[model samples]
Target: MRTGGKRTASVFLLLTVLLLLLFYCNLALGTRFFSPAKLFSLLSQGRGNDPAVSILFKIRLPRALMALFLGGALAVSGFLLQTYFANPIAGPFVLGVSSGARLAVALCMMLFMAQNRALSSFALVFAAFLGSLVSLGILLAVSQRVRQMAGLLVAGIMIGYICSAATDFLLSFAADSEIVSLHSWSQGSFSGMSLAQVRTAAVLIGISAFALLFLAKPLAAVQLGESYAESLGVNVRRMRSALIILASLLAATVTAFAGPVSFVGVASPFLIQSLLKSNKPLLVLPASFLGGAVFCLASDLIARTAFQPTELALSTVTSFFGAPIVLWLLVKRRGK
Candidate 1:
């Protein structure tokens, strides 16, 4: 095998190892620690009214799996946005997509709570997807006027602020009961994940991720430039649309489930590309998915365990680490 292929293979192997290790840690090191052998025995045995089994299957296991799937979805979404915008820093969060999704989900939740009705998972995802498209549309319009990538980024940030403010305004009118749920979701979290929710997220994310993988070759060509891709018989417009829809869908699913996790979208792809030393979509796509899983698993672990019974919001931990990496990227880009 070629040296580059070998390196990519090695990186994937390392990321897989890290992903497994973090997944294990997430399951093992919660408020109650479980040993590896005990965890295995519990997993292999019947539940039969065992609290530990319940904790493992119902609580810790679902949470860990949610992080794995949704984190990967968020990262892949970010990579798609970055590729589409031809900007390394462009992401669902930075581009206001997550905020848009958050706003929509918040509205959906508020409406349902006002009616004393439950919001279905499908409805939640649809609201978020619609919100993401709205945000993406606004950014696309702004991008036309603001030619500079920096200006577009600032505009995206401003859009995010506007959505967040609107969400806050909505929150002010929410009943106390509503606020408890909305407040937790608005802050971003991976808690309270059920097997059902995990199944929904897994199905949505898995399909979207597979679609993106299928388009990896064409997306690579698109990244080279639209005209170039078109010259190669790729329908650049259709490809771009697919990119937008798929990216939005992935971002929306994450927001619907996890309340708009920050930084994983931007940081994971950048880290993967840097580590892989290549920007080819075929290589970066899968690696970024795995990298994102590892990133969120590790972050989720820290968020819950760092305070010991006082869990921090997932976004807080992500931003703490991700923000520095973004700043460093900006500085490095400026130097270049």
Candidate 2:
């Protein structure tokens, strides 16, 4: 195999191994540890009256699967945004898309709670999707006037700040009861995930990923330049719109389920691209998905276990690893 191809294969193999290992770790090692053989035996019995079975099926399994799917969704969303913006660091979180979704979900939850009604999974997803669109809309408007990519990034950061501040303000007026519920979600976590919710997220992310795979050719073309893409018969406007919607959908689905995860989006794609030594969309897209799953599983494992009974928020672990990667990318790009 060619050097780049060999590198790609090696990296992908490594990511897959890590993903499986971490998936096992997330399930087998928790407040109560389960050995691999025991976990397998529990699974074979199917839902039973045993407490260990309940923990395995109802809790650990669902949480692990959610992290696997949602983590991939976040990374794919980030990859799509980076392609659209032609900026390596561009991602849903950095661009305020996730924040927008978070704000919407928070608002929806608060309203539903006030009415003494609970939001269905689908309703939360819809609300998050709407918020993501709104954030992207604002970012697009800023892009129109801000000629420089750096300026547009700065604007995105400001928009994120504004949305976050709005969320906090809303929280201040919320009931203590509401605060207790929202506080846990707002901090970001994979805890409390259910099998039904996992199905919802998996279906949504599955569809988005399917669409993304088909868009790879045009995405690569657009990455080179709009003019080149146009020459290749790619409708730049339609492609741009599709990219925005897909990115938003992926980000929204994740936020709807896991609150707002940090850094997986930005860090995963960069690491994947660097490892593969290529920017080819088809190659990077799937690899980024796997890389993201591994990253999140590792981070989540650390977050829960690092403090024993006291668990850290998901973002706390992600930012700890993700921030330095972002900083390195910034400094490396600035020199070029």
Candidate 3:
């Protein structure tokens, strides 16, 4: 047991080091070059006329931070959902929460763009939150009486399909310009994130992540079944409600800020579980967060620098990496 614990600790340490290295690489590389020392100097002092510093500090920095927090939030949210549902494939997007947010944002953008009124980023984010909450409410209602996890999962999928259909209808009927804006938002980009946007994402994700930490034990207990958890003094109903809310909040916040980034939530927890060889939420949640941040940061680096002059869509980049991982997980589990 001691040897196993030591090996786990060693692996975690290695992952931590790798994550830090990726984060530094995110800060160091961009469209314009900025060495580590120079970037540090500019951040500590001020960039007067150096466009590299401006790009690094103003553009790349915030975007990278946003990606980190948003990715971590999504992964942790996925972890909670998988734990709650006892399904390895469960994730935030699977529940239609992200689609709900996308639907709301599409409407908000269509309304404002049509009227030539400026829509605050915060307002768009709030609309997404509202949409996610509505979907979450429906899921909670169904889950309360459904009893069967498979039935609840089916209901979530139906809700997602409904939201997707609505979003498509809106796009089909909207003006060309509004459609363009909505399309870009849905495709998901980390570009153009201001510091204020980063701060908002940080606060929301931080709060939700902290709340989830408190539920780690209960969530683990939940895996044995609700009645089993209740026998151990866990309040199954309250625990589920809190977990759902936290997962929704994390998913909504990330979707609102980063435009429904694909697959990190689904990928990260599964990856961590594979690495750890255990289903313990206590270990899984934090590892998922770190793994998510590392994945996003590394992907963002490739998206920005892979083509050098032109930037790639963040979602496309993630999908390139995430889809295969998801498929492999499914296949591997099927084999087991």
Which window of 10 residues has the lowest lDDT sum in candidate 1? 205-214
Query: Which residue pairs collide in model 3, if any?
Result: none
The lDDT values for all models are 0.93, 0.92, 0.82
lDDT of 2 at 244: 95
lDDT of 1 at 318: 97
Residues 1-336 of candidate 3: C-alpha lDDT, one tens digit per residue: 888677668758977997888877888876556687887788887657877767777887898888788888889988888877778777877777888988888888888888999877668778888898898788878988998766886788899889989988989998887777677677787778888888888888878777877888888888878889999999998998788778878888888777877778898888888888877887888888888888888888898899978878888998899989888977987799
Lowest lDDT sum, 10 consecutive residues, model 3, at 27-36
lDDT (10s digit) by residue, model 1, range 288-311: 999999999999999999998899
lDDT of 1: 0.93
The digit string of per-residue lDDT tens for model 2 on 43-156 reads 899877899998988888999998899999899999989988989899989999999999999999999999999899989999999999999999999888998999999999
Evaluate model 2: give its lDDT.
Answer: 0.92
RMSD for each of the candidates: 0.9, 0.9, 2.5
